[model samples]
Target: MSKFKYLIDGIVKNNPTFVLVLGMCPTLATTTSAVNGMGMGLATMAVLLCSNMVISLLAPVIPNKVRIPCYIVVIAAFVTVVQLVMQAYTPGLYETLGIFIPLIVVNCIVLGRAEAFANKHSVLESALDGLGIGIGFTLALTCIGLVREVLGNLSAFENKFSSSDGMLVFVLAPGAFLVLGYLMVLFNKLKDRKKKA
Candidate 1:
């Protein structure tokens, strides 16, 4: 496949969130608001990009037996950097994201890309793949967050539209699953329609 295909595929065809259904913890937990969702997505993207490139570069020398451990170390390193930076700069978002931030080290999307794509692809290709997947994940979280916020809070990005709550359920755990299920169906339908066309 071409380099650009790596990028586009993640955003639409092989989206981590909507398509692959990876990273559900952060997706469901942090997306109570658009800003929180976007923040978590961007943080994951940063880790993915860096880890993919590093893993791709180190693939040749990494022993097969130790590869998984090495990958974790690399991912953990980047995650620590992200955690510290977020803690220092965006303390509120940092707090909101909380444990989910560090958990990116174990995120399936990140690790799966490292093992499945990064280890085999060139550095550039791996980076692009990471970026594509990251963008896709970001968009999915943002959309879910937007929907939940608008419906539950009667607001967008925490901006209040009215004094009264819209649908309290949407702001809670159950609402994440509800919104995700509907969005997943909607996305799949679109994909199927495009394929038929």
Candidate 2:
């Protein structure tokens, strides 16, 4: 039950998006469409999962003075794997994500997990944390992408419901901020209500 809490905490309480508010760059940039958002989210998840387990296994041997660098090297290795896999099989998404794919190395969510949770926890716990946080992040991105695509492109999952554009601004950078802000508010309200109950 204690181990499972690590998983649940990430998805709801410590969500990288709405709660902790980590990884804002990719959260905003890669979510222009649901496909792109999911692609990025999955790629990040893969890296996070692999890196977390590896970091947990290696934490004991890593010297305290250089733990950060060691963690980053582990993360970068996983990110490279994800990038190569995406480029080979999903070239379109690979192209769409562009530099952001490589930029996952610096994403606060991944690194923060490594330093904060993975290093201190067992491999199974770390893996759960990574998976839960990854799922939360993916859901957040997908929801934002869905909203943006539906409103901005007048489509859902690329299916056009209206011949005319919905709201062009929702597809732009400004729209990303607006949607994120609104969603943050909504999430907080729901969580607040849940707490009150």
Candidate 3:
């Protein structure tokens, strides 16, 4: 049950993107398409997993004063690896993702988990935390991307399913914000209703 708490934290209570709303830059910018969303999510997931593992292993050795720096170094190392590997193998995605990929080093989601959860937890716990948070982030991004693509660009939903112009708001950058904001409001309302019932 304790392990599952990580899931709750990442998905509902402490989401890196929507709930806590960290990493807004990429959340707003890279979510123009489903492809870009997946690319960013996968890249971020890799960095989170590796950093969490490293932090868990070094939890004992990482000093209290220099803990932040140590966690960052570990996270940055994984981000660099993800950047290089993506550049070599998925040049198209790398190009599309652009500077956001490099920005993973500073992304609060990855570093936040490292410091708040991973460093204080056992290796298994840290790994689970990383996975949960990573998945939550990916899910949120994908939803945002889908809405943006379908509403901002008519081709987004139609291209995947049938052949018709759906709407253009889903593709534009402004549409992402609009959709996300509404979604957040809806989620909050739903949560409140559940609490009262």
Candidate 4:
């Protein structure tokens, strides 16, 4: 049904990272390691879910002229909550993500979902959309992080791949782009094959 479609769309068909290509800033910047990627993804997911639900609930009451600002305010509030909680509990990740944590306020995925999907959808639907997109984003980042980690640092999920040195470039900014680009190509090829069949 329509509800299921939203989930599928966000995860596979219109994934914010690979398919729609939104929020590339955090996608590229925070995915230096699997832990960092998952942390950033979860942080963004929390904000995305909260903002989507709140925005959907308030859409009717919010004035059209000021909706964007209102959405940003709501998102910023949630981002602050996530930031504080992470800082208090996960200081290492907090320090690793640093300014990017606060920068979630402007992530296009959150704002775009608020405007494009959440505002127009029911509360439940908005939440599901956020969840699906958030998961997809998380998975994408984790995969990229895993690849970079294994190849660049010879580790994954805290497991050592080898004592030998990995390709250092895979851990750098350029490595992020290289991995992401190739992943996009692979995803597109699979999608094309699916369509043809």
lDDT per model vs. reference: 0.94, 0.94, 0.81, 0.93
Candidate 4 deviant stretches above 4 angstroms: none
Q: Which candidate leads in TM-score?
A: 2
Q: Tell me each candidate's TM-score.
A: 0.97, 0.98, 0.89, 0.97
lDDT of 3: 0.81
> For residue 196, what is the lDDT in candidate 3?
100
How well is each residue in 1-197 modelled by candidate 1, as lDDT tens digits? 67899999999889998878898999999999899999999999999999999999999999899999999999999999999999999999999889999999889999999999999999999999999999999999999999999999999888898999699899899999999999999988998999999
Tell me the tens digit of each residue's lDDT in model 3 across 72-173. 888888888999999999999899889999899888888888878888889888888888788888888877787777665644523665466656666676
Clash-forming residue pairs, model 1: none
Pairs of residues clashing in candidate 2: none
- Residue 30, model 3: lDDT of 91
> Residue 162 CA error for candidate 4 (Å)?
0.6
lDDT of 3 at 120: 80
lDDT by residue for model 2 (88-164), tens: 99999999999999999999999999999999999999999999999999999999999999989989888899998
